[model samples]
Target: MKTQIEQIKVKNFRLYRDLHITDLQRLNVFLGANGSGKTTFFKVFNFLSTCLKDNVTVAVNREGGFKELITRNSDPEKNFIEFEIKFRNFEQGEKSPLVTYHLKIGFNHGKVFIDKEVLKYRRGQRGKPWHFLDYSKGIGSAIKNEQDYDPKSKEIREDQPLGAEDILALKGLGQFERYKTIKSFRTLLEQWLVSNLQNEEMRKIGDVGADQQLSMSGNNLAQVASFIHEYHPDIFQTILTKMKQRVPGIDKVDIAINEAGQILLKFGDNSFTAPFISKYTSDGTIKMFAYLVLLHDPTPRPLLCIEEPENYLYPTLLRELAAELREYAVRGGQVFVSTHSPDFVDALQIEELFLVKKEQNQGCSHIFSAKKYDDGQISELYDNGCELGWLWQHDYFKGINP
Candidate 1:
């Protein structure tokens, strides 16, 4: 089954209180100045995936406990941090159906607990979505036989006294194959990655191995580069060709084994007869190459979150990077990028773009589509041959403009 989360609803979480983004395209670009909750938005996925790694308690603790995670002016009535994700799940030979997973977390004495968790989907073309996996305060039931049937009707449900509130029901049922939908959803969540790549790590010699996927810090960049070469030569060759095309005088990319049995990245330039090791490579070259190693993986992750991809690259390379991200989307992978580069935004469509900002009066920050502002004048800019990046660079999209 192929799945991608299409919508996010957050309440009392970080700077977001009662926020929802419904229309999510495969490729999403978040444009905002610093301290506008862009990285906080990315942390939403990070938090959920962390929940899968352990429990909500551990996940909450990892981020300095629940108080640090919840919004400062959090609603008094809403004691729990809530997150809801709507996903389009495409099962074998079936039209993709919208599946929603909701979680509410509460904290007590610095301990986090799952206040409420529900996973459901609409049974037919219309009606209330059926809750296949529903649990509250560590006790509830799940519809075992999740085959095509009326979940609204009284179907066979298995009573599962899930041990504790802190432990997620999705975590428990996901381990059993009998809970097919639960397992698939868990696997999908587990596949999500939030990338905060470190340039220094990419520059260093990495472990002598080929990771199935790139690490969050990209410490395995060399191994991933070597991996594609040894396992997927076609992908590696394509990356090399792109590297040469994007980076001037980059003719080849080699993966060499060090005396210590570690993997290193070596680049060849036409000017030099000998290839220069990664230590000598430009920062931009290594960053771009690492991105290729990630985006071109044979088993692409269902969801990817990258922060400021334009960090070390030249402005001209932003367009090429954006194109590759779109290609990843075209291949059915969902990518979310938070970038401040207008050059990168210039390559994105208005529908694929979002503006995030903080309002003093409201005392919160949130993300919104261009359609929500100036009666949809944002799209008109594109019609008038003015790209989103240009308008944003000129401070046009932040507020309504003539």
Candidate 2:
């Protein structure tokens, strides 16, 4: 609830070629066919997070280097992988002016570096916007007195020179608390959770200790479970209550550290006296429990990107899961989910649902709200007692085939 992305723009990044999406919701759901660029869309945040945490070079190399990261069949000479995000932090309690962060990654002669980066916000109701942080390649200038910045008076500025050309300016400047705008954006990037949960990873035993937040993959489910059970008993009990209601016969959930200093998750069934270890539990049970642990975390992450949560979960359970995701968003974390389940879509509001589709021949993806299709026919259909899932399956969302 502190800050949320309202608009995102990407240019020459994989399947997205000059795509601009606006008015993002807190609990946004993306629907698309396989290979229609739903996963690629989520990767945008992952790519930015990696760039901020490490460097531009590392982020590029992680995605198979520059050649593989850029858009396919595009001119390398003219195009650079660019991303721009606009959001409001709500730091002043009421609605605040939009903060814009723009980043450009360029490659030349086998070298990848940050071409440009800027973080700026409009001052007052008019005039030119104030640039809090601005850099190109390895050097630029940033406003030193951001709190008392006055465009009408002489502006105080500081020259910033990074150690490497491939480094993000925010990564360097954010380390200092004086750069409040840069630090806030950096913290937001660091707290984003782009979850692509692997059930197999959740089943494996993990190192001893507790993690306040869940990893992109739910590998440390046991440690997190242990942490919640030991500190936040009320939240843990709520998780158990929800699990029992959704998954029949799940009486209790607990965790233990083995003699080797590894944490193991356990489940109890009312029908049996002996508790079942996570390794012996059903896939649905482990997945559901992992989700519960993640949602019940004491400190919710700023943003959550989950792809296909309906996988390995009962169709009937998906609607409630959708509701839970919305509730988590209500608790101050914005969630982005990509799903193929209609039951999940049926639980969503019109503003929360968007359709992602690849353009014919162009081979690039475009995203827009479902409520905007065919002069609001989709909205009209939904208002007339038709569920979104049925409408989507029947090819009512335009350009999306059943």
Q: Write the per-residue lDDT of candidate 1 for residues 1-402, one digit (tens) a residue.
A: 457677899998878987898688878988777777899999988889888878888888888877788888654344889999998777633566778899998876656778789998886777667777888889999986777456366556888987787888888899998887788889878988899888888888987875768999998888888878998999999999899889999999988998999987889999999999988888888898889888998887888889999999999999999999999877867889999888998999878888887776776887888655567777777789998888886777854221
Relative to the true structure, how large is the alpha-carbon lDDT of every model?
A: 0.84, 0.88
Candidate 2, residues 1-402: lDDT per residue as tens digits?
A: 477899999999999998898879889999988888899999999999999898999999999988888899876656799999998886655657789999998988888988899999887678578888889989998889877865465457899899988999999899998888888899899899899888889998989875877888888888888888999999999999998998899988878778998998889999998998899999999999999988887898889989999999999998889888999987888899999999899989988999998887898898888888678899899999999999988888888652
Name model 2 segments beyond 4 Å from true. Answer: 149-154
Rate residue 125 of model 2 by lDDT: 79
Global fold similarity of model 1 (TM-score): 0.95
TM-score of each: 0.95, 0.97
